[model samples]
Target: MNKQDALSIVETHLTKKRFEHTVRVAETAVTLANLYQVSAKKAEIAAIFHDYCKYRSLEEMMRIIETSYLPKDLLLYHHELWHGPVASIKVEEEYGITDEEIKSAIYCHTTGKAHMGKLDLIIFVADYIEPGRSFPGLEEVREMATTDLLKTAWMISRNTINFLMEKKNRIYPDTFHAYNDLTRLLDGGNHFEQNAIGNIETSSGSM
Candidate 1:
């Protein structure tokens, strides 16, 4: 779908604030997609519908998870993580967006999965560092995004894991999976490199 059409459809499902965030994420995702030599159109659509199911009632989300191919383990985690997986299925079933790249980007946008593709990394990082967001170290990630998508993704995953640990919240397994894979892709880091993650981690940040 074209940008306007996609935005119009998604807007109906989101609150005013969330719709604005979605638009910014789409814009950011497109920028990263271009920078990383990925498809901007696909990035835009996936980011647009990334939170299509965000406002769904927990009961509805639970039913969708229980009945669909989405894993049952999701029920064991916080409902915040359910929207991405639910929206992945909803977008395809409701909008005929069967492309795996778009679906996967939406599916793992919340807690990124291991071995993500270019489009998946674009959406995950874009969603986190979108201008509308105000997380700690967000500016650094945004700057890194202008050049290196992979390293920026690695930073996001690391910071997310750190933030959750500080809050003493239980992180979803895929979150750790993303961090482990990105750490490997980046060939691991030295202690000082690990300390860089500490710069933005002093304050609490959303995942």
Candidate 2:
């Protein structure tokens, strides 16, 4: 589907807030796509559909997963990660969205995969830094997306893994894979050491 067609479908399917987020991510994806020399149209379409299934009830998502061919390990330990791929299937089955780049971007936007392409990176980072997600270090990530997309993805992936650990949640293996893949890109550091230290210092100063 083209940009406007995709936007309309997303608008009709998503709630008002989600629709807004989709638009924001679309814009952000377009910006990153231009910077990275990827297709702006494909980036926007992927961003628009990336969260199409995000607000579906857990039961609904589970039902979709149950019917799909996603592996048992993914259904068990990485179900959170499966939703994106499941949603990609639904997008195609429901809307005839056969564009490979858009479908692949939606499929991996949640936990990421090994060897992501430029459009994948754009959609991933756009979803992360969309305006409403006002998490700490987002500004740094946003800046890094322009200058260093892979490094920014690495930082975000590490922070996501740590957050899940603190909550005693089941971490998706794909997330770990994504982190390790980016760590190799980091050219070697103590993973999150310096960032954690800087965050602690900043928190103490703020207090």
For candidate 2, the per-residue lDDT at 3 reads: 79
lDDT of 1 by residue, 70-122 (tens): 99999999999999999998888888888877888899998998878777888
Full-model lDDT for every candidate: 0.86, 0.75
TM-score of each: 0.89, 0.83
Of candidate 1, the 10-residue stretch with the lowest lDDT total is 198-207
- On residues 1-207, what C-alpha lDDT tens digit does candidate 2 reach at each position? 677887887787788998898899999998887777676777777898898887677777777777777645666764457668877888888887776667778988888766666666678888998877897778988888889877878878888888899999998777888888778757765434533311212111100
RMSD of each: 8.7, 10.7
